[model samples]
Target: MRKTAPKKRRWSSGGLAAKQFSAKMANNEKCETKPEQSEKNEVLEELNSQKRKFDKIAEKLQSIEETVSKIAKLNDDEEKSMMKFKEQIESLEKSNLLNDRSNEKLVTRKSFVVKYVFENLEKYKFDISKEEEHFSMNWHMEMQKNNGYLGIYLFAEPIPPFNDDWSIEAKLEFKMIGKNNSSVIKTGEGIFEGLDGNGFDDFLKWEEMREDYLIDNKLTVEVNVEILKRTGFGKNNIREFDESQKEVSDVILVVQDTKFYVQKMYLALQSSYFKALFFGKFNESEKSEIELKDIEADDFQNFLELIHGESSVDDDTVTGILNLADMYDSPTAIRRCEEFLLKKSKKSTVQKLQLALRCNLEHLKNKCLSKITTISDIKSIMAANLPEMDLSTSQALLQKSLGFWDE
Candidate 1:
């Protein structure tokens, strides 16, 4: 067996070369596999990013749709409300109860009340021409509740050297009417007095004029009135009537200067009594010896010329005379007022200033048809115009026209 050991065989050149080629191929496969794995991981990350972006876009679209729906609903509601308001306005128009002419209606009401009161005064024979009247009334039911009630007020323009003390008197009587109509009530009275100048400063004067009556279960009523004239420094003198004879009732008025004996009578109306019967104007017939200061002779003569004027005089001429009198503080202003009262119409009511400022014959003629109620009103109006007439004295007159400190 020791002799049989074979000699070691050497490798072939081709076989070794083949073995090296196989090793190079295996390394190339490993490198290609690693690059493919890296590319797959990058593709997966890109897909996830695209999916997240799509989800955000979808959420935004859903929010926009909801907002659009809410906006459409709000628009519909507004349109409905507007239609309802329009319909209501049309209904009001058809009814004619709600008015478009509210200011006109208010003016009508004021004018009507004034006319009513004026007529009532005429029935009372209060000599609207000689005596002054003042009043205030409620504009509404609510005003009546809060401010009491409506009343007609009467007053006199105090004679110069005016004093506050004045007399006021009132009386009342009533009678029941026919059958079951006893529920209706009427009243009558005989004397009334105006407050003195001081009444302007105090409202209690109004309370003194008011009166109330109580009846026992009477339904319908009527009344008769008799007012006698009497005068005192602070109170009125009332007369007692003989219950049997209605005609003989009378009273005497004693003023500081003279005495007035009057026979009083009354007339009946729907809701009130008229205050006038017949009165005779008389001056001191007998007792003339007492020497009291007489009204100045010039004043007395001028007063006569004013109320009873010559008819042929021109209106502008009178206006000029009055304006000059006002400037110099003459009594002629009172005369002009008397003339204006005699020749007044609706058109001339607001022309006091116009005529005074332009003192032309044409302007004065035009003013002939104005409503001039009182001398004081005209004088006040003319005085108000003085500043506007002369530019040189305008500033001074303007200060005066603002009215006195007392006003």
Candidate 2:
């Protein structure tokens, strides 16, 4: 019974001692674990903050990559747009058209008259209008009539065929209104067919005869009435007259609205074959008979100096003569002037000399004789400043005039 009571006490003591030991160990472990857990929590918190910053930086990188791609695409688009604009601007610049009146063609038929008969119309004459254009020269002279037309040409002539030596015959083929169809045509066949050579002189003689006949007949008679009657144009072909029964001084042309008073005078002179009349140096006929056509150009110029002596002159004709004289020295022209130029004005005589010299007319030197003043005047003329006078002459008169008689 005593042992049993003590057992309960022993049990209680043991249980209480165990419980206290357990409580003490548990407290020590709690103290050590609490500091370690706090350090781990702080490390984990810092890791979380670092992870959030990394996530933000990664998002920013992705946005920058996308923006870079957009910028690259924009750059490509700008380049392409600039290229397209340059191409469009180049296509708009190269298509433009001239405006002037003188460049136009001559339109009227009535504008074909002149001082000389046109070599083309051998049978038909030209018709002219009243108003004269500054650039146009068209007028008509009365001639023989053929068919219903009063003209110098029977038909237009063709240019010479391959074998024909006469090339001037081709000019007649100019365009004109046709007789039959009333349309433009080139039916250029002359009514007269004759070989041209020495035979051509006969044609010229025929033309001269025809011209003489017309002039003589018209000068002596009221020929317009007969001409109108012959043309078969009744009252429509009437001629105009003055109150005094005198024919109007103006020429009546085919163009109905116009008339003009253009008169031409031709003067001819006689040449001597012997008996030097002016200064006894040379005969006029001998100068004329030198056959300038046969002489070479230089020889002819020397001959001009011998005949004309020395002269002062101006004009294209004189220039041409001086050139020819410098080159050929035709004695015929030169000597002719020396014999002829006396009692003539320096102006008119010099003018004639200039013209004859230029035209290469050995015969015309005689026409300037009245212009010489003195031997000094001749020397002055020789010394006068002229570009073309720079040639040596064989004529004694010219040599003396130039102070080179010894040379």
Candidate 3:
């Protein structure tokens, strides 16, 4: 009875309460762990999103860098292409200039012909002796083109007897007559003295004469005879003095604040520039004094001295004198200056070469070139004072250098 009673009461209150408490504690622990896991998952998702955004930005930056690199390469290519095009254009222009120069040289090798004749043999004859004791004759001269040569032939009638000890002298003048007698194209004087009874005959190459001297295929010839007179102390003999006084200077040349008393005739005879300024149709012909600008007084004085044949040339003054001679168109002074420069060219090679190029002195230029023996000498000359040279002179020097290399 006692054992049965204990089993029936096996479910006590205290044991039941403990079992409920344990179950409740297990449920609360599960709820707390669920919230913590949810929160951790949300944080992981946010981190993944940020990583994707960073990857996308990196990809865009790489694309932009590639585009910039390609653009820079294209710009470089364009610059190279433009440089090549410009070089090609310069080459084409140089080729065109060479072609033009070649065309000009072909046109300068042309020739022309001219001729003339004279008549009336007796109209130009004169007696050589007062008593007419010496033999004399009348002659006619003719000028004509024969086989591309100018032929000057003299014709005479009743040929004079030839004498071994005596010779008949005749003076002949040839003139190129212009249209309407405007001006004499040119005049040539010749003297003929020989014992040969046959008249004198002369020939000249047509190409050798000046082109301006030939006028409308015609020329004129005049003949005169030299008279012989006895020379002794006699009543008929008289002493004569020149009695020709120099005319007063009519023009004054003021150069660099210095005044120069210049004769119009003297200047006109020495320089065509002065002749035109003083005697031509210009207004300066009426002026008594001309003020020259940009001319040095000392240089002008040296020029005057050269013209008057009262000075000697030196290295220091030769270049200045040559420049003045060229400016004034004084051929005599030019010739004199060129002669002096040519003699000094051996010692002053570079100086004379530069001067020759500046003054257009062909013979002096040739002499200067002859003095240079090697390419080193040429290079030295070109390097020295190159900036002081003019454009034409520089071009001439380049051409000369090229010629030397070609040789």
Candidate 2 segments whose C-alpha is farther than 4 A from its true place: 1-259, 262-352, 359-375, 382-398, 402-407
Of 1 and 3, the candidate ahead on TM-score is 3
Q: Which ten residues in a row are the worst by lDDT in model 1?
A: 18-27
Q: Which order, best to worst by TM-score?
A: 3, 1, 2
lDDT of 3 by residue, 55-143 (tens): 67679989999986875676777869867888999777554532333343122111111122333212321111111111123344333
Q: Provide the global lDDT of candidate 2 against the true structure.
A: 0.27
Report the poorest 10 consecutive residues by lDDT, candidate 2: 221-230
RMSD of 2: 57.9
Model 2, span 1-407: residue lDDT tens: 00001123311211111000011000111122222334234333333444565567679999999986875666767868866765666433110000111122111111111122223233333222122111111112222323333222221112212222212221122112111212111212221122210001011123433343233122111000000100111111122222232242322111222222211110001112112221233332223112222112322232233333434222212333333433333345434443343333233344445434443444544444334434544433332222112122113224333342222
Task: For each candidate in the order shown, give its overall lDDT on alpha carbons.
Answer: 0.28, 0.27, 0.46
TM-score of 2: 0.16
Under the 3 Å rule for N, CA and C atoms, how many clashes does model 3 have? 0
Q: What is the lDDT of candidate 3?
A: 0.46
For model 2, state the Cα shift of residue 370 in Å: 10
